[model samples]
Target: MRCPFCGNLETQVKDSRPSEDGAAIRRRRSCQECNGRFTTFERVQLRELMIVKRSGRRTPFDRTKLERSIAIATRKRPVDQEQVDRMVSGIVRELESMGETDIQSEVVGELVMKALRSLDVVAYVRYASVYRDFRETSDFAKFLGDEGLSDNEDT
Candidate 1:
């Protein structure tokens, strides 16, 4: 592996173990030239999954992009990084197990909303605002009502 710190070509693996979810292998490595340490993860790619956007455009599924969106929703909240990772992994697993190479972007958005809803209400609302494209306060009011929540609920 290439050392990220010094751009060294050679690196030595000091330790290896399965991640908490058992979906990836975590490896601790040190750069041979600089002695800088870093961690890496290895995951199995079952197949190429494509995301079909609302515009009818097809693009490859990106886990990082999903993570970023979730992070933004959970920002400044009590949610932790591990929970976000688990949510992303769970969604990917669900998508892969469906036995479909192409999935709708709407499906992904709904899954995220579901996950965030259970994790944190604030994060859920934050994500829903963007995903549902709320243009005004009534949009949020309607969503809250539909979800059995009152707009006066304590934040």
Candidate 2:
């Protein structure tokens, strides 16, 4: 690695440690020329995963976009922030396990739906309504009918 201080090409690693997330290696290095010390982090560069939309359009995967949607759906709900964080982490893990650079947006949505369904029914419905673009009340009714959720669960 090139030294950041004097653009020296030679450097020696003084120490190394794994980052808390375990996704990267933190290394302390000293420049051979200037004796300047600096820290460098090395992380595995994952391949760009393309999200294939329902309209056959491909877009880059965005974590913030996913978080925002889930957050909006979970607003005013009893679900804790930790649960949301875990749900997001689980989805990322599942996606990474696919071992493919390209994934369908529908697949991501379905994963989130399944996770949210067991976590909070209200949040699940909110997310589904936005995701499915429910045109009328009948759409929600159909979902309720299909899932067998009724007024009894509301209390």
The prediction achieving the highest lDDT against the true structure is 1
Expressed as tens digits, the lDDT of each residue in 48-148 for candidate 1 is: 99999999999999999999999999999999999999999999999999899999999999999999999999999999999999999999999999998
Position 67, candidate 2: lDDT: 78
Kindly report which residue pairs in candidate 1 clash with one another.
none
Candidates' TM-scores? 0.93, 0.69
What lDDT does model 2 reach? 0.86
Model 1 misplaced stretches (Cα beyond 4 Å): 151-155
Q: Which window of ten consecutive residues has the lowest lDDT sum in model 2?
A: 40-49
Instruction: Give per-model CA RMSD.
Output: 1.5, 6.4
True-structure Cα RMSD, model 2: 6.4
Candidate 1 similarity to native, TM-score: 0.93
lDDT of 1 at 37: 94
